[model samples]
Target: MNSDWLAGGRAELAAERILDAVRTVFIDHGVSGVGMTEVAEAAGCSRATLYRYFENRQALYVAFAGRETRALIERIWRDREVSVDRSPAQQLLDQLTAVLAEVRKTPHLAVWFEPANAGIVAQLANSPGVVDALAANFVARFRPGLSAPAAGRVGRWVVRAVVSLLTLPGSNEDEERAMLRTFVLPFVLDEHTVID
Candidate 1:
């Protein structure tokens, strides 16, 4: 019951509240439609308190996106572990399935898929740390011996294709995964025809 400890605890609580509010707002309104006032109302705190934690809407958006992306990477890593008995093809297929499932479940991810939110995504695209982290995660999961460039290109294609499928109207995840298996699994297992 020290006064300073109470003050710090209150501050931490407020920050968490604001972050949760921002996340909800982003999910409901996407990036362009959300504002500080709405975030403040969502957090049940004044605009001043919101500003204390986040400098501006863009900053909050970036922070929220970063948190969501980190969470996704963490979940994928947690759910997947390469085993000695599993073939590289099997590992890649498993990783793809898990990642697609995670993306479907994560709310904020829909914003990035929106055409109007392209600018926000472009900002993240330029971040070297994010790129490196993504590459490392892919390399670790697929354990592919391909050159970095080749891996990067193929990974991008697979991820985008998977995202396209998940975002489709009334798409069945299980069906899509099965379809992807027919296409992706074959390419990974055989070097005869790379997917063009």
Candidate 2:
């Protein structure tokens, strides 16, 4: 891997391109259903080349999760779907709803929530790294003055809510919104957010 990288190939760019290919494969075969060979083939790279970038299935999963989560979060905020005029609680609700909608619309992401893949999705979503990043970026913007650990706790709860909903959505958006209002908002925003 290093030798090829040293020979002038951009490893990061190669890895990202492979991941892009991996997404369409995941769409065809749910995240858990896709094998490494399938990934390598879809990436149009030899298995050795794929493994050079991603050591194994788990590494690929983590890399994919990190990349996609960051992209999704960036898109949600960039869209400005959550209005400034709304209360923080409403804004939070809008953000959560936006995440669900976004994921559902994207085939690769939607497949990740398939019943067979839900366990893997849950594990990755609840991982400390994901939670911490979400806390530092997402939670911090809403729950200012909270410590990193505190924000992380909030982030974990949010992840749980998201995974649960993704795995088993409610009958309708109203019900989902209500569930978040009843279950999520209290714990996440239990402490009043200090807006500046």
TM-score of each: 0.62, 0.88
Would you list the clashing residue pairs of candidate 2?
A: none
lDDT of 2: 0.81
Candidate 1 ranges beyond 4 A from true positions: 1-8, 128-135, 140-196
Q: For model 2, how does the per-residue alpha-carbon lDDT over 1-196 read when each residue is reduced to its tens digit?
A: 2335324656558899788988999988888888889988787777888888889998898888888988998989989665668998998888889899999998888888888997898778766675467546687777677887777777776788888998999999999999999998877776764322
| Model 1 global lDDT (CA atoms, 0 to 1) | 0.65
Local distance difference test, per candidate?
0.65, 0.81
Clashing pairs in 1: none
lDDT per residue (tens digit) for residues 47-86 in model 1: 7767888898767766665566677867777777768898
Runs of candidate 2 exceeding 4 Å displacement: 1-8, 81-84, 192-196
Return the lDDT, model 2, position 37. 92
The numbered model that scores best in lDDT is 2
